[model samples]
Target: MRKTLLTIAATCMWLAGTTAFGQGKTCEEAAPWSNMAMVMDLASYADGGAWYKITPTANSMLPFSLTELPTSAVQVFKGCNGEKALVMSEEVASGNISYYIESGVEYMIKLDVSQATGSFVMAMATPLDLSNAPDGNYCVKPINASVGMYSSIKANRPTWFKVNIVYPGMYSVGSGFSVPAEGAAVTSVKVKSGDCGAVENSSNLLMPNQVYAKAGENFFCVTCSGDMKVLFQMVSPVASCPNHPERMTALSAGVEVTYPNAVYENYWRFIAPETATYQILDKAPQGTILQVGTLDENDDAKFFCNFENGLMAEVDESGEGKLLVDMQAGQTYVIASETFNMLAEGVPSVKISKDETGVRSVSGSSRDIKVSKVAENEYRVSSYLLAEGAGVYVYDMAGRAVSSLNVRPEGDAVTVKLAGVPAGTYMFLIVGRSKSASTKVLVD
Candidate 1:
């Protein structure tokens, strides 16, 4: 009886191989496998299993899937002899599996199954190259472009694109395609500098995916699970304030202008007529967000300060929606205003005026108070106006008070120490009984 069963199995195997099962049953006779090729009806063969060999020309991360697996496991080995199993199926779904391979290495994949009468399809995925894709700009409207060759992202694998950035700033990448709710979500979207060696930043498929990129060639790797027809859009901070003259309004001192009720934010360009401290006041309803900054040659936002709900530290208790900023002569600055709810209602007015408080000038002061850096984190403040128990305060560029101390003048100068203060540009304000002086200092 045992010999009869063995003979029947051998005859079945021979008949299957001669008819529809051409794949090798042993590692030594494994057939060659190529990228994006599908092997159909793999489980219909009478042989217990089949083997296929793969040789990658370049290092790659490949994903393999089975339509209807009839076995418990599928494995990849380092060589045909199966001495070492590099990876095994994790079964993301019932039969889907993925693995990574290196260049110049031979890999043998085995589909382990016993005489199953069912059929299954095996498919492999390869990376899609977009290294030479044209550069995209955030300031311009996005145009749809086809991405992968396959219809499904699961079969297309990861898609890589290069970004040539001329300016270092905050940027965002968004996809026009989305995975179906029934399908798996996108695995990852990564940003790398120079090459695809290491990931510098990653983003989700949803939300405003943002990444801070430097000036150079940056690479992006996107992996998804659904449709492959994706259109990726890159957005920069400049997208908010376009370079058109109509978009950036010119703001002059002492001139008040009514902001139109619009959904988008409004921008104002202010070129300092003279080097002085100026105050920007927003009389826009009760809640509004104000931002002040300058655009570099590349139109990247820099030195920006956000006043949440139009509130600033410089404003007094009675003052609302006011910001005092020290501006330099001949330098251009940008002022942006937006409603708290992202939609403006009624009339919103903004005004820029010179701040003529008793505070000394930032560039040069005619006040009696004088401040000089004595050491790395130490400064000598001298002034006859600084009486006993005078208040000394330090503020950062964002108008936030960092440190404050009360001291008595040591003869002509009082040593003020900033031990924990970080190195940057700061403002020092010294207040006496009836007078106050402020000067800007750079700490190294």
Candidate 2:
């Protein structure tokens, strides 16, 4: 999986071809600097370091890396919004992180400088040559086996991969590997036997230590008792010809969905625009069991929760589909569906909608506007002092402006009793010469 690599920090002060040098290192000083290439001599600071704040380009996969001059004294922390951060130390040298930094969002990188021999360099990796494939498994035998090319742990059993060790010297887990299990480390990586039988010629290699092997075809099986993420590593110099990894194309909210008519299984993805309860309605009678869950960067289902409430249908009866979920903002939700038997026609199409009654604000505007449901399918929009060019407009839950509420000022406050739209909740947008505001109004 090709994820946005964003593990890095830098504050630039460039003079065309000139670089800024620093000695007194402290995060308090570096906190205010803009993201640019910088060099600091941490040898003078002794144990002091600085924090580099980076607000990367939105929706871009920024690949960044850091390399210490002599020793590994850099502790990089990843966090935001005053949350406890996951710290990385060992992966700084000759390692990288790909992150999709949201546009105009600030990320803090705290640098804890320790064993600085003399001086060190820090640079934000920009203009990445992504024409190279990402780091992962390559050149394997038996291309049809699920256990051949980069295998994920299935249950508590060991997974195996056979790599043609042409330039084999040492192999260890790379920086792209994930280890979420508490205290989860490489247990034992050694040669595996053919078929479902005893062990063949095997040599166990513990993690953090690269194992040496002769140049030939080698078979290795990774066995970790506890559940953890693992990947194949080619620590030797022969690792080349990288292919750009396949990425998941995410679906955005508030858009009509296209029904999938696959024979057996169907898959989809969506990104929640905000924290709200969303409904996926089945529009046909195929009796499809809809399942929603979280997908890892590999687009693999990680975990799924029971629906708080979902509509059920009989074998041939129509389904009043309603799968409600509290989706978190910016999180990706995976959707999959299955049925007792495949249906060639009338394979239900799904629709997603959010309840607008509790919708606080969509567009963040400063103008004070009030909205209230008065009668069935009627709403009253009022403003104390309207801007010169202030105009009130009504929009459906999908944000398509349906009607305009023309409010002639009565006195100090301006009120418009408008109705005659479809029965449902609607969002009111007030746009003026100098400002704007959004409010929700419900109609029975």
Off by over 4 Å in 2: 1-36, 40-47, 59-104, 127-444
Error of 1 at 348 (Å): 16
Per-residue lDDT tens digits for candidate 1, residues 118-231, read 454444545322223333211011122322221233422565556565533455543345435455445565555433332245554463345544345666555656544444
**RMSD, one per candidate, in order:** 22.0, 22.6
Best by lDDT: 1
User: lDDT tens digits, residues 89-148, model 2?
Assistant: 124446554333334555555444454333655545452222242222211222222211
CA-lDDT, candidates in order = 0.53, 0.44
TM-score for each model: 0.26, 0.24
